[model samples]
Target: MEIRWLEAFVAVAEELHFGRAAARLRLAQSPLSQTIRKLEKELGTTLFDRSTRSVALTPAGHAFLPHAHRVFEELELGRQATRATAGVVYGTVSIGFSGALNHLTLPPLTRAVRQRYPEVQLSLTGRVMTGDGVEQLEQGGLDIAFVGLPIDPSPVRTRLIGREPLGAALPIDHPLARESAIDLADLADEGFITTPAAAGSALQELATQACVKAGFRPRVVQEITDPYMILTLVSAGVGVALMSSGVAGIMPSSATFVPLRGEPTYMDHALAWLDDNPSPVLKAVLALAEEVLPTPER
Candidate 1:
């Protein structure tokens, strides 16, 4: 079918609302509805189940969505290849990074890319948790991402970039805060603060797993997304938190970070990208990342 038809289909599929999809595409609602109908007829299958109340994708639509995204990705790749033939490496590489990498890794990597490829543009989105970054990479929204490790290995390729011990954040006046290193079992009865489970935080998983191995389940008192907020809550004596030792640099004055003893717990950091992505610009960036920021040895 026509490219416009696929565009209309993707917009409606993502928005799931005829009016909003039409507005997003800058088309009249009536025409947008007609376009969907035409696309459905051409494909010989219904894509969405619609009612006055809501819109939902049919099974066929679910299966077709990823392919639809691939079409646009391929088109962009072709355009980049054409530019490359003219001796110019140019394209926007969208990158997503979690807050953990904000202090050390991301800044250097970004500067290297800009300096090496002046014509290439880097689109950066920060505070993107691990789970969201993976979803964005799968959907073609991000070309590369710095994500937490111990993730599923399929669909995406990853390389270890950094590793650091996991530690505890406690109120400065807390009894355990005076110790050189604290054991997970020592804090078993203490209320804990952590990132949301739904956000797919590997750090959260690691902390929970460590506590489980220590014999008792941690009683979570609060869930937060920001590292600063988590530390702030800890400083207020809301609860203790398990965090990367790197966070010690930014630790609030009222809070203290102590290494986990008994068991050496650590958080692994990695760079991830889709294996099937054909963007030449992405390839260039990945190469630059390798040279500028070499993967740390395990």
Candidate 2:
């Protein structure tokens, strides 16, 4: 039976009088009586014994009253849950990123989101991938991604939330490290620590391209996967690699970071999500990412 029928049955059962039940339900007496009859008809049993003067629950009405109460409670809960999910409350947002994730000021951004949308549970994952983290977002596995931007994406929406300039991760005492500002050309003959090209790391590709623009194809002395490993290699004098300016934050004490000129550097690093209807939590996280991530001086 319909929710209205159940409500009328409960109201009439509680009041035990036609006029009083109608008043409690904000319905007229005749309609209230008709509603109770429909519920009884649907159930093929008399739920209430009604006379011209008073109303009383039959055996079936007594049996059904508790069930009717529970049904209305469930409907109320469903409406509340709908409202929560329709907005930003009570959701778990999954975010993905690449190597420069830590460099994008995400920890602070995440903290802000936690404080503001406390009900929106956050799950953050970092993967070193060969593709723009956009693909996972498209497949509904990720709500947003932080990665190098100005990326040519395949049917995804991207915001360039940060800009990390090119810097060198070099041993502090290395001859080139002494330069106040290094040019890409200065490192043309230097050995390089490279990441695997097969993993679709755009940042690694950008570093190699910077070397090419500076007049030398880098000699890859090591192929390491992690950004931490990249810095370690540089500190040990295995090679000097072009890196995000924020690399300085995680660099070893033995290494130095210097701004590079003519570096073919990237100014737009990205936060990306699917082009489909996105969740409000994703939107909030994007706003926080945009707020915290810094841009280059253009």
Encode model 1's per-residue lDDT on 1-298: one tens digit a residue: 9889999999999999999999999999999999999999999999999999999999999998888988987887788899999978889999998775356778888899888889998898877778878889998789998888978666988888889888899999999898998778999889999988898888889889889989989999999887678889999999999988888888889999998887577788889999888889999899989987788887
lDDT tens per residue, model 2, 1-298: 7988888888888888878878988889899878887888899999878787767788888998888887875665465467666664556678776555355466777787888778778888776443636667666677777766555647777766666777788988899887888778777778888767776677778887777777788888888767777888788888887777877777888888888766348635666777563455566667666666644456
The reply for model 1, stretches above 4 Å from the true place, is 8-67, 118-141, 153-155, 178-180, 197-200, 212-216, 261-263
The lDDT of model 2 is 0.73
Please list the C-alpha lDDT of all candidates, in the order they appear.
0.88, 0.73
lDDT for 94 in candidate 2 is 82
After superposing candidate 2 on the true structure, give the runs of residues whose Cα lies further than 4 Å from its correct spot: 1-88, 99-101, 130-132, 262-264, 293-297
Q: How many angstroms is residue 66 displaced in model 1 relative to the true structure, after the best TM-score fit?
A: 4.6
Output the lDDT of residue 99, model 1. Answer: 72
Best by TM-score: 1
